[model samples]
Target: MSTVLPDQLGHFGRFGGRFMPEALIAPLDELTRAWQEAMADPEFTGEFDRMLREYAGVPSLLYDATRLSEAAGARILLKREDLNHTGAHKVRNALGQALLTKRMGKTRVIAETGAGQHGVATATACAYLDLECVVYMGEVDTERQALNVARMKLLGAEVISVKTGSRTLKDAINDALRDWVASVDKTHYILGTAAGAHPFPAMVRDFVRGIGDEARAQSLELLGRLPDAAVASVGGGSNAIGLFAAFIPDAEVKLYGIEPGGDGFETGRHAATISAGQVGVLHGARSFLLQDEDGQTIESHSISAGLDYPGVGPEHAWLADTGRASYRPITDAEAMEAFRLLSRTEGIIPAIESAHAVAGALDIAKELGPEATILVNLSGRGDKDMDTASKWFGLIDAPEAGRE
Candidate 1:
């Protein structure tokens, strides 16, 4: 790669821009400059690869899911990022960028999180790299994902709760952006999605492409052919893209991006962007967003913290628009059922976000029959969701239970 900066400003084909206050321009310039150099540096390459292999556990296997296939009626496989060190694909991009932050001489990592998986992953990187970590989460998310909150605290991160707006992911991003503008020095915004401003979609995609790269090679080696379809849950859509990108040029593979439908799509309480969305601007990128008729972003509700955001990634928007990929919604109840079934039947407790993908796979499998192969990106594990799961399943007290 040439690693050259584009004079055209921060854009990925009319999707991303640094649309921010004037005072933030200089820091964005500095960030762009440093990232360009870091990409070109041989020292950074060697170190990043070493850390990926030794610490973060790159090259997670693509396994043939015989049981899932048998039950679902299609031959199924999984690119198991859930097996990664921090139990999520988020760590791959987080670690790569945290290393770059060190190279830029920045000592703090800041990010906005919804479900808190990204926050925990970033905090883990800061712990290893000895950098300060700050995460902004919506107050509602902080309450829903308390286990992840404790995980970040255990990893030495400071979490701030934003009570503004609707107390969800969109508000969290706004709050994080505010913090970024204020503390431009010693702080790199460790964005969780492959969206946001320029350099982010492409940059994060490049870093996390390891998942797809590995899956492609591993699938062929194990199955002796390309899978019929690849599926991943899309919140901000990094995992889906990371896995889908490597298979796009294959031509034989069908790609599906599963978004969270908190309820039914017609019910208005969902995050099914491509399925129930419109073109809108959010978090510095133009993507399919859950917005109202007046263009205000609507609050998306999903049982999965990782998939409760209002926007799909910019690249995903392009893919859906261009007809290169398919996007669909899997409802919250369906996802929870899939999560529990996968655990009980196969001992795999997938992250709720990942469970959405599994739920999609089951539906696809029924249509494809037993001969077709489907590869799902198991984006993360579900251990961080024990509390929420217990409550949701009625095994424990609800937040408002016994409130007579």
Candidate 2:
């Protein structure tokens, strides 16, 4: 919980630091200074707070999911971030960075996204702030998350499909960073998650830490104490880190980060970086990454586009190393099953990314027994994932002509 992490150089115990091209140093420095100044300024902070409450719909509900608890064999409370303006926790970081962009006198914002929630959030922020926006998304993700892509377009943001590399989150980041290197003068690259270099890991966490902040107070009010565990799905780890931040000081509150186990560990197609990856540098940070023997980044697979990244935020890497938090993988099948279960039981269709955490929490609930309470960050809704969910669940099958 100390501010010491990310040191003066942005390294989180040899995990985070600028690994970008030299050309980016000046802009990164500028952004860091701007963020610091904004954080220290009451007007900036006040406006940001106002926007979160009035616009992004912060202080999201912490609902007690009684039905879900019965299914999991443990008390369950869900921090419902899915009800945010852009339908995901990504909106917090997007709005924060967008405000910083304006404060820095930048007129344009460029971002990269997977599953398209971040892109949609960025586009929404840009529209609200009257700034130009551009989003880079993987070709595969654009197809799977078409609804979000359409939302971004309707918000007046330009969406570019990056077809390079694995055509996923990592590759989209590659193209976004490339764009930033050339447009740093008039543009700000709103890195979607907490991964990237230096300030991003720290700054994005600060922006989204509201999740944990609210959840902590709500838990005390509702449950009369902290939950036994804080749970969330981790890809670039923004939501997980946000939810874990406020609980870090509570030694009794365990943290669980669920990574995507796409097809299972033996298949080598999962994105369970912290659980199975080797330490390596990727996307400008040293973290646990899925890579080959030759040190090439491996292509990560997941039923959920948002949880399909190959590397995690460096802070998560540090947490895993320090054993302050536990990281595990929930296979795609397990995640999908949870996804279906939540929809049927509670009428809450979670984003497949969040389903990973749901699946993990169920197992943890059983392990900890019925007396324990588990808080899960329901990071986003499944509206944007209808296409993928329909395909996965076979919900689009042809109906009988006279069935009605």
| Residue clash pairs of candidate 2 | none
The C-alpha lDDT values of all candidates are 0.85, 0.93
- Which lDDT tens digits does candidate 1 get at residues 300-333? 8888878888887777887776677899899988
RMSD of candidate 1 to the truth, in angstroms, is 2.8
Candidate 1 Cα errors over 4 Å, as ranges: 1-14, 396-404
Model 1 error, position 153 (Å)? 1.2
| Candidate 1 overall lDDT versus native | 0.85
**TM-score of candidate 1 to 2 decimals:** 0.94
Root-mean-square deviation of each candidate, in angstroms? Answer: 2.8, 2.6
Per-candidate TM-score against the hidden true structure: 0.94, 0.97
Model 2 agreement with the true structure over 25-92: per-residue lDDT tens digits: 99999999999899999999999999999999998999999999998999999999999988999999
